[model samples]
Target: MARLREEAERVQAALGAAEVQLERLGQARETVTEVLAEPDAATTGQARPR
Candidate 1:
């Protein structure tokens, strides 16, 4: 019974870590989507040199 409980605890910890990783990946996807949706100045031929 103790071994079973330990296994469950380990699985729970792994799940928690996976959830955090998933959230970060979701946020990164959103940022990339937003950037892709925007028009690029260079592509529009309106780019100015710094």
Candidate 2:
């Protein structure tokens, strides 16, 4: 019973983290859309640590 409870808590925590990440991704999409609306600096990629 105790183990089951612990597992449930862990699952709940992971789910919460996933939700937060999803929200951040949504916000990032909105930001990109706004940035791209200018048609000047419309681009995206990646950069490694300096």
Candidate 3:
């Protein structure tokens, strides 16, 4: 039982880490999309200053 509990805890920790990473990736994608949506960003390769 204790061993199972430990494994569960480890898996939970890893899941939490993955969730955080996913969130970060999502935010990055949003930023990139927004940048690309800007006028002539693709041609000039410049993003507007935040």
Candidate 4:
């Protein structure tokens, strides 16, 4: 019973970490989507200086 409890705790900790990673990935996807939705600099005739 103690071993089972320890396994459960480990699984819970891993799940928490996974959730945080997922949230960060979701935010990154949102940022990329927003950037892609914007007009392209080339098309707008406003080239970005490198």
**Which model scores highest in lDDT?**
4
Candidate 2 to native Cα RMSD, angstroms: 7.0
Would you list the C-alpha lDDT of every candidate in the order shown? 0.92, 0.82, 0.91, 0.94
Candidate 3: stretches off by over 4 Å: 41-47
For model 2, name the residue pairs that clash: none
lDDT of 4 at 44: 98
RMSD of each: 3.1, 7.0, 3.3, 2.0
For candidate 4, lDDT tens digit of each residue in 1-50?
Answer: 99999999999999999999999999999989988997899899987565
Local accuracy of candidate 3 as per-residue lDDT tens digits, 1-50: 99999999999999999999999999999999986777885577886575
Model 4 spans with C-alpha error above 4 angstroms:
47-50
Tens digit per residue, CA lDDT, model 2, 1-50: 99999999999999999999999999999988976675443243444234
Query: What ranges in model 2 sit over 4 Å off?
Result: 39-50
Q: Is candidate 2 or candidate 3 better by TM-score?
A: 3
Candidate 1: residue 41 lDDT (0-100): 80
Q: Record all residue pairs in model 3 with backbone atoms less than 3 Å apart, i.e. clashing.
A: none
